[model samples]
Target: MNFKELGISEDIIQVLKNTGITKPTVIQQESIRFIKEGRDVIAEAQTGTGKTLAFLLPIFENISPNINTVQVLIVSPTRELAIQLTEVAMKLKEAKDINILAAYGGKDIGSQLKKLKGNIHLIIATPGRLLDHLRRKTIDLSKLKTLVLDEADQMLFMGFKNEVEAIIKETNKKRQTLCFSATMDSQVKKLAYRYMNDPLMVTVKKEEVTLNNIKQHVVETTDRRKQDALCKVLDEDNPFMAIIFCRTKRRADNLEVALHQRGYNCEKLHGDLIQAKRERIMKAFRNADIQYLIATDVAARGLDVSGVGHIYNYDIPENVETYIHRIGRTGRAGETGYTCLFIDPKDQRTLEEIEKTIKFKIPRRELNI
Candidate 1:
């Protein structure tokens, strides 16, 4: 269906078309009408499925520019996601002059306070900082018409369930609520039951967690020689743009340094980096100035880069869900992609668990080099 049929404005549709998003995604098609109808919705969709636009489009339709006093509140788990949401909102609302603010920690609270005092139409915030604002009573949610919990599973995983509940209590009970997640775990369901009023559940399912267009392979190597194994794989793939997932920030930092020393165009992303630097790195990577991005799971939560041709698991994630999320970075937007995972002996059990979760064994390759 077209964006106009989904009740998106002609101006916003033009903006989307200019951005090359003419057709609605699966998540967008399912969730937009429900959201526009003012129904509570629990939408479960995979990463890179255009979930952001699903909720945002409905919000843009509902918000009124004349009576703006924070009509919509979007709570996200990570600052990166919050920032990305704010960017999308700004683009859609630019012609309409709707004010948008992204509130998150690791930034100046005084400045956020100043923005909060203005006639803001929408706010995209992390739970911690939004709670801070709630505590200070600097922002009022009395006029809120909608509340969005983006990445609900991730918020619960980060131990923000209580915070999220508290934030919801501050909003009007009759207000529209929407929860979006990659998985509809029990916690997400409970939150929906307790808060949402007869919510519509929408899920985009896959027979397996792995993507069909993505070629997956595993390289067996010793822990001591895993670095060499990764180098060998990079030499072979020569990907146009790649992301390497590490288990920790220290590992990401070390890999960034090592890869640069080896003369690869690479960058590192983790929690330790300041917000400005993180944005700069993301910008560079999107522009293809940085060919490889080494990141931790938390740091890569809201990454929506296109043309990510390869994903390298420098260290296998502890769980199958994380592995799916990490590899979901590639094989997006109908593009074929590749994934190479380096596994050590100690990771055999985890590999088995991953295989069990995804319901297929990844083809194994010996590190012949």
Candidate 2:
């Protein structure tokens, strides 16, 4: 069904149409009614299932107008996700008037404090940084009508349980709560029910959706010749924007350095860098100042960017889920995308497992170089 049938306003629906999203995904279709009805919701869906829009659409639909005293608080696990959410919020806000602040680590607290003094109706933030604001009394949550925990599993996985509890305790007890997660692990469920007043659980599970839109290839190469193999593929393809998935921070760092020496424009993203630097690099990449981003899975969680044409697996993920998630970064918003996965002799077993899980034999592509 279309978003308009789901009771979304013409302005928001028009903005989504401009972005080329016409139909509502299953998660969006199921969760929007509950959110609009003012029920606490725990939604479980896979990556790339359009979970962001599900909560965002309803939040915007029910936002109390013109009060401007932090009516909504959305907690994210990572800085990248927070920024991405802000971008989405801005799109809807542009259609109307909603003052928003993205509060995360590595930003200047003084600047955030100054912004807090303004008419901010919503604050999208990371748990630690949000708690810091609460401790400093720089943010007011007394008027908060809604609380959203995006990527709930990741927040708990990243060891933010205590910090999240602290933030929840500070918010209005009567506020509506929405927790969105890829998996509803027990911990995530406990958090949802503990603070929520009789929450509703909704799940959208479609295993084949991740592989539906992307063209995938497996390249056979030796471990020592991987760098050269990657260069050949990149040179031949010349992608618009690509994401290279590495296994660790060190590998991403080393791969970026080697690619740069070979006259390729790229950057590495990991937890090791300070948050400010990560934000700057992401901004540059998003603005097309850079064409390639080499990053670990943890560093790229909840990363949603449009126009990503290629995904390269420099290192095979440990499981099928991660492999699917990596490929999902491309082929977004109904666009066909390309993926090239380099496999060494030692990686054969892992490749076989991934193929088994997806139930499709990834075709082998040979390079003349």
TM-score between candidate 2 and the true structure: 0.93
| Model 2 agreement with the true structure over 1-369: per-residue lDDT tens digits | 788888899999899989878899888989898898899999898777888889989888888766768888999998889988988899899667877888887777577557557678888999988888799888889878999999999999999999999998899989999999988999998888899988888987755347788999999999799899999999999999999999999999899999999989899999999887888888888877889999999889877777789999988889888899899888865788899999899999999999998899999999987
Q: lDDT winner among the candidates?
A: 2
Query: How does candidate 2 score on lDDT?
Result: 0.88
Model 2: how far is 87 from its true place, Å? Answer: 1.6
For residues 18-119, write the lDDT of model 1, one tens digit per residue. Answer: 777889988899999989999999998877888999999989888898895889999999989887787778788764678787789776767755755677
State each model's CA lDDT, in order: 0.87, 0.88
TM-score of each: 0.93, 0.93
Runs in model 2 lying further than 4 Å from the true structure = 116-118, 206-208
